[model samples]
Target: MGKEFRCGYGKFEVKKMLKNYLLFGLVALFAGLSLRAYAADDKFYSAEQKIVELKEEFNLPSLSVAIGLNNRLAFARAVGYSDIEKDLEANTDTQYSVGSLSKPMTGLAVARLVATGKLDLRQPVSDYLERPQYTSKFSIAKLAAHTAGVPHDTPERDLAEFIDVKDHQRPMDAFYVFDKHPLLFEPGTGQHYSSNGYILLSAVIEEASSKGYVDYLSSEVWDRLGMKATELDTSFAGQESEATYYSSVNKEGLHVRSLDKRDRSFLFGGGGFISTPTDLVRMAQATYGVGYLSVEALQALSMPVKLRSGEINEEKYSLGWRVASVKLGKDDKSWLALHHGGVTDNAATAYLLVVPECKASIAFATNYVPGQFWRMRGRITSILKEYIDIQSCDRWSFAQSSVDA
Candidate 1:
C-alpha cells in the first residue's frame, strides 16, 4: 500500500513539471516575438533616404535638411550638387540664401532687446526714427506681425535695385524705397505680407541697439546661437562654400545657371540671411527651447496678434513666425506648429517648422526651385512625425531599457 501511494505521487509530480515547462516555453516564445515586433516598429527613415527622395522628387540641384530634437540636432543631410557647373557636392555646411526665413532670427533679435529693456514692442516706430514722411502710429509689434498697413512689393517698381544700392552695404538703406510711401491701411486694421515692414523694423533695431542691423543680428542672434556658418547673403562674387543659386527657367529646363544676382541686403530683416540647414535648426531649437527667451518674450514672438476690431488675424502671422496647427499623421491629432518660409528671386527657398509640443524642429533649404516650399515642408514634417511617433511608442521604452541593460 505504501509503494502504490508513492508511485501515484511521483506520476502527479511528473505531469505538473511537464505542464510548467510547456507554459514557460510558450511565454519565452511570445516575448521573443513581441521584441521583434517592437524593433520593427522602431524602424525610421534615415537622413540619406529622405534627402535622396526629396532630391529626386523635386529635381533639386541641391537640397539640405536638418532635424532637431530635445534642443539638439539629431540629423542633418545635404544631397545633390551645390554648383552643377563646378561639380561641387552640397553638404551640411554649404550655405544657401534663407530668404524670408530670416524673419524669425530678426524676431529673436527683437525679443532679446525686449528682454533687456532696450526696445519696446508696443512703441511707435516714430519714436526711434526722425520724423517720417508717412505719419501713422505703427508700433514695433505691428511691424513684426505684418499688420502695420505696409504695402508689399509693387509690380511696377524695381525696389530691389533701388534698395540694394552699393551691394547692400547698408541694410537700413532699404528704407529709402518705402519710407515715403503711404500706409496701405490704418495700423492694426489689417495684415499684409510686407517685406518693407521688416525693413522698417531693421531700421528701428539699429536705432534702439545703436548697432548696425547685420552687426546686431550677428552678435545677438547668430553668435549667441553658435551658428558659425550663418551670415548675411551679401554677394555671390568671391563667396566660397556658398551654393550657387540656380533656376529651371533656362531653354533646356536643365540648363542650371547661377541666379545669385540680387543684392539680398535689400531684404535685410525680411530675407537677407544665408545659412546651412543645421544652423537654422540650431537657431529654431534655441529660440523655442526653454532658457533662451523669457516666457513673455516667447509669447510675444509666437502668439497671433488680434486686429483693432478684436478679429483674429487670418494669416496667423505671429511676429516673424506663422503659427498654425499641423496634422502630423493620418491618425494623430493636429499639433501646433510655429513655422516660416522664404522664397527668393534667385530660386532659393527656405522653410522652417518648429513643433513646440514635441520639442522638434526642422529646417530645409534648396538652392534652386522656389514656390515648392510647402511640399518640402510636408515631406520633412512627415519624416519627423514618424520619428516622434516611434519615440513615443511603448516598444521604444522597452528597447531603450534593453539597450540600457
Candidate 2:
C-alpha cells in the first residue's frame, strides 16, 4: 500500500510541473506579440502617414516639420510645394516666417545679456532707452514678460501705415509706431500681450549690447546655436529660397499672395524671423539644456509675471515664452511644456513645442494659412505622442547644474 501511494504522488507532481511549463511558454509568446505590436506603432512611417493625410485634408500648399528626441533632432520632413505656381517642392531647408515664435528668441537674447551682467531684468527700461517716454515705472523684465501694461497692439491705422512703409529697419524706427500710446494700466499691475513691448526690448538690446538687433541675434543666438539657415523675415525681392506665402481667401482653399508687406525692420524683435524646423528645434534644445543661458537666467526667462496683489498673470507670459502643461497620452501624466506659435495675416503659420520632461521638441511650419490651422496643430501633437516616450528627471537638480560656472 505504501508503494502504490508513492507512485500516485510522483505522477501528480509530474503533471503539476508540465502545467507550469505550459503556462510559462504561453506568457512568453504573449509578451513577444505585445512587443511586436508596440514596435509597429512606434514606426516613423506612422507619423509620415498622418502628415500626408493632414496635408491632403488641410489642402496645404506646403508643410515642414522637425521632431527632436532626447535633446536631439530625430526627424524632419517637408511636403508639398514652396511655390505652387512654380511647383517648387518644399524641403527641410525651406524657411518660413515663425510669427510670435520670434518672441522666445528675443527673450533668449535678453537672457544672454542678463547672464553676462550687461542688462538687469528689474532695471527700468527707460534707463536704457534714450528718450525715456514711459509715464509709469516699467522695468525691462516687465517688458520682456508683457506685464508692463502696454497696449497689446499698435493702433490699427498706425499699423496699416507702418506696413506700407518700405525701409524701416532700425528697432528705434519701429518705436515711433506705438511710443505715443499711453500705458493701458499701471505697470506690473496687469498683463497684456504687446508686440510693442518687444519692439521696445529690441531697442534695449541694441542700446545695452551696442549691436544692431539683427546682428546681435545672428551672432549671439543664431551662430551660437548653429542655425545657419535662419534670417530676419524681410522683403522677398531677393529671397529665392524663401517659401511663398499662401492664405485661404474664400470657400476655395489656398490662394497665393505676396508676403505681408510689413517692414521687418519695424517688426524687429517682435515677429520678423524666418527659420527652418531643424534650426528651431536646435535653438529650443540649446536654450532648454545647458551651454546657452545660466540656470538663474533660464529661470527668469520662465518666471511668470505677477500682478500688484501678488497674483500670477493669467496669460502665463514668461519673458518671451508661454509656459503650460501638456498631456502626452491618455494614461500618461501631464508635464510642463514651453511653447510658442506664429501666424502672419497673409503669409504662413508656425508652432514650436518643447517638453523638458522628455527632452523633446517639435517645430512645424506651413506655407498655407487657413483658419483651421490651429486644429491641425493639435492633431500633429497627438500623432507625435504616440511614438515618443516621456522620461522623468530631477528637473530642479538639472537646472541647478546649468547655473554653475
Judged by lDDT, which candidate is best? 2
After superposition, the stretches of candidate 1 with alpha carbons farther than 4 Å from their true spots are 1-45, 155-159, 162-165, 236-238, 249-253, 329-332, 370-373, 389-405
In angstroms, how far off is 130's CA in candidate 1?
A: 2.5
Q: What C-alpha lDDT does candidate 1 achieve relative to the native structure?
A: 0.71
lDDT tens digits by residue: candidate 1, 263-334 = 767778878788888988788865553477776566776677777877657687776888877776666776
Best by TM-score: 2
Error of 1 at 116 (Å): 1.5
> How do all models score by TM-score?
0.81, 0.83
Regions of candidate 2 where Cα sits further than 4 Å from its true position: 1-42, 156-163, 236-238, 249-254, 258-262, 329-332, 392-394, 398-405
lDDT of 2 by residue, 117-233 (tens): 898887888788855378238888778777787775666425533546555567777666677788888887778888778878888899899998889999999999878888876
Clashing pairs in 1: none
